[model samples]
Target: MINTILVTDDNVLDNAIIRNYLYKERYNIVSALNGREALELLESRNIDLILLDMVMPVMDGYEFMKVFSKTPFYKEIPIIVTSSLDGVENIEKILEYDVFDYIIKPLDHINRLILVNKIKTAVKHRNLISDLNKATKIIDTLSTTKNI
Candidate 1:
């Protein structure tokens, strides 16, 4: 189960709205004023997903992604960019960063639920792969023992 999420946005109202919505759905949340603060929170807490804003003071989404891509923990952490700029050009720009999805402002209930489910599915798939790798390791050990 996804226990928590990090919602990174400079706008207080946007963060509050999203936070309240998620909270009502029983998801614990942590809000970050900017990408830098988000990074710090991520380091200190176990966050399942990040709803990142494209523009902000301190560090922006692009900068965050650049740093995050290098770290093992951040590499697979699904990021859905939630911004008001959902124009074709803006979407193109964000897609270049390799985010999981692009969500526009005034997030509707249906789309929000879809986003949550997508994260759940990804987490499930990741866990299955991890399990498969573990099983393969065990099988390898057994085969080696038999050969010995």
Candidate 2:
């Protein structure tokens, strides 16, 4: 299945660059200008992943993550922070949101490869978790039947 990715960034050029990089992967790309828009999209779309920018107007990445984390339905969606902010402190701050990974902005060919690889890894992880949940449910049902 083709995964849908939400790209939230105030910079139009940055969004375009990311779109270009992911185009080859055939992701159903959805763009949002800020956190508010991203939240709105999330309400209506089954987004598989998110590419977020740290500094944005209306709502920044941290603010978005705060709300996203609190929402149980959104907690499973893996987020990859794509930001210009780079430092041990900054990375730690973003990591606190339970993001899948963080990538420095101004992406190039090498970074694009890195981003694609990370996306693949995250997708695999999500699929594994889903399968495990399904297996657990089946086991629970089997146990209940055996007890009857």
Candidate 3:
């Protein structure tokens, strides 16, 4: 279960819209105006996934990804890019970070549902990978113990 979600966007209205759609689902929602604030929140909170916007003041999404990817906690949380920018260069830059998925802005009803589905899938995928890593660690430990 994805218990906590971070919504990072410079647009206040856009953040509100996302909150409205997700409120019924009852997940703990955390908001940040930009990547710098998001990073501050992540330092103290447990975030299952992030709904990130590409354009923002202070720190953009690409800068966030670069910093996030270097952290030890990167693998535990998944990020879904929800941005208004459609430029080819923007997409290519975001792709380099290997985000869970990229979602364009102006989400209609169908697109909203699609976004929710994608979030669910990404959360499940992150959890599965985490579990696999734990199992691999256990196996490695056992192998080392047997050798000793």
What is each predicted model's overall lDDT from 0 to 1? 0.80, 0.90, 0.88
Model 2 clash tally, residue pairs = 0
Expressed as tens digits, the lDDT of each residue in 50-129 for candidate 2 is 99999999999999999999999887789999999999999998998889999997788899889889988887776777
> lDDT tens string, model 1, 1-148?
6558799999998888788877876777999989899989998998777889888999988888888878875765778888878789888878987787777776678767776676566556555656787999999999999999
Residue 83's lDDT in candidate 2: 95
lDDT of 3: 0.88
Counted clashes in each candidate structure: 0, 0, 0
Q: List the residue pairs that clash in candidate 1.
A: none
Error of 2 at 129 (Å): 1.5
List CA RMSD, all candidates. Answer: 3.0, 1.4, 1.8
What C-alpha lDDT, on a 0 to 100 scale, does residue 116 get in candidate 3?
Answer: 84
lDDT of 2 at 3: 84
* TM-score of decoy 1: 0.77
Q: Which ten residues in a row have the lowest lDDT in candidate 2?
A: 122-131
